[model samples]
Target: VCSPEYWVRHVREAVRFADGVRALEAQGVSRFVEVGPDGVLTAMARECLTAEEPSAPVLVPVLRKDRPETRVLTTALAELHVHGVPVDWERLFAGRDARRVELPTYAFQRERYWLEALTSFASDVTAVGLIPPTHPLLGAAVELPDADGFLFT
Candidate 1:
């Protein structure tokens, strides 16, 4: 069901997602992975593909309803890898002794006035924006340098 806020905010751009998918398709973006609570946009995305694409782009989901989380994720990752997406294998192995290599070239360092401007970089707000309460993952948001966007978790 659509909410009143959604009707107001998104009715103007009801085809936004499908249009975005078409744009990506035009740019030769064939692989799509919807990393959400479940597979919501897969069908709509598939529908957006054009016949000129040679083949419909591979679409995968990270989550599914009534399915084991780990199993679904692993299968999706494997499918993506098979379809030529370069996922970092190192992400699967955590807390292991990671080997580091030193660079042969010397490094250059530069100082910034902004670094000394505030005790906490997070406190400085260059812009303020509101994420609607009806937003899927972000119920609210405040940009911070300490973290990427908001912590929906």
Candidate 2:
């Protein structure tokens, strides 16, 4: 699972990796295979490759869905077959099982009183024209950019 903060920080990294892969495709790299538990990276790779080279080679993911081991392996083999890659289904499906584990639960709740206080402070800052309305961080918090004017100093 990726958080908004994680996306904000690594989006540029993803873009850079895509650019490099696209360059490789320009040099006759035919196929791009993304092997991982999830296909999020593959989706990003498709976006990058499409932007750089529309006719690039096939982008394949080893795991197509979040499911039991059997389903995951079956989907992977099917994808390979669709791409004309031969595989031993028995060997691939060997030692696969559906394992279940308990996940922890948290009972924390948001502090409404804190949120209200922050919102009120933010309104005051906005009214004073300290931060522009178009600023990306404007709606996230209730703090003036330079409440003490130390930023300019």
Candidate 3:
């Protein structure tokens, strides 16, 4: 590949592109990352992989034509991450103020965002068939032993 004759032959002779992909697939390589100005080979790689295999390889393009470079690269990284690729986040965000946030453990489900306001039960707890909590701010009214005496929190 480094020789001048190889380059000349590469241009003059037919290139075994699919054969190279097949060879890599034979070696148990199931991930292909294309580092180029544009994702020209990605589509070709996908076509080559679809014809032969038990599993299709994940094709990732680091840079895409007519797209933001950072967004394309980030999306590629996210795809790789979803495919179980181990990324060194510490090194990736060495100089950036990136922080790890706690994600929801449960699967997020689609829910209605615009809901009608709930009727206020704070005005009267008994209306909801519930007793008020015995907190310092609010508590159930208690009758004192003496007449015309009531305790309130």
TM-score of each: 0.50, 0.40, 0.60
Ranking by TM-score: 3, 1, 2
lDDT of 3 by residue, 47-99 (tens): 77744553457888888776678767877887888888988877887888998
Q: 1 or 2, which is superior by TM-score?
A: 1
**Model 2, residue 102: what's the lDDT?**
54
- Model 3 lDDT at residue 30: 90
lDDT string, candidate 2, 1-153, tens digits? 279886787765544686777797678666666777766676677676644545435666666453455555566567657767787755665687744465446544553333334555655555543433455544533322212122210
Between candidates 1 and 3, the one scoring higher on TM-score is 3
The worst-scoring run of ten residues by lDDT in candidate 1 lies at 144-153
Q: What is the lDDT of residue 35 in candidate 1?
A: 88
Better of 2 and 3 by TM-score: 3
Ranking by lDDT: 3, 1, 2
Query: Candidate 1 local accuracy as lDDT?
Result: 0.67
State the displacement of the C-alpha of residue 48, model 1, in Å, after optimal TM-score superposition: 0.9
Model 3 lDDT, full chain set? 0.74
Give the per-residue lDDT of model 1 (tens digit) for 57-118: 88887887766798678778878888888877577746768655665354444633342445
Q: How many residue pairs clash in each candidate?
A: 0, 0, 0
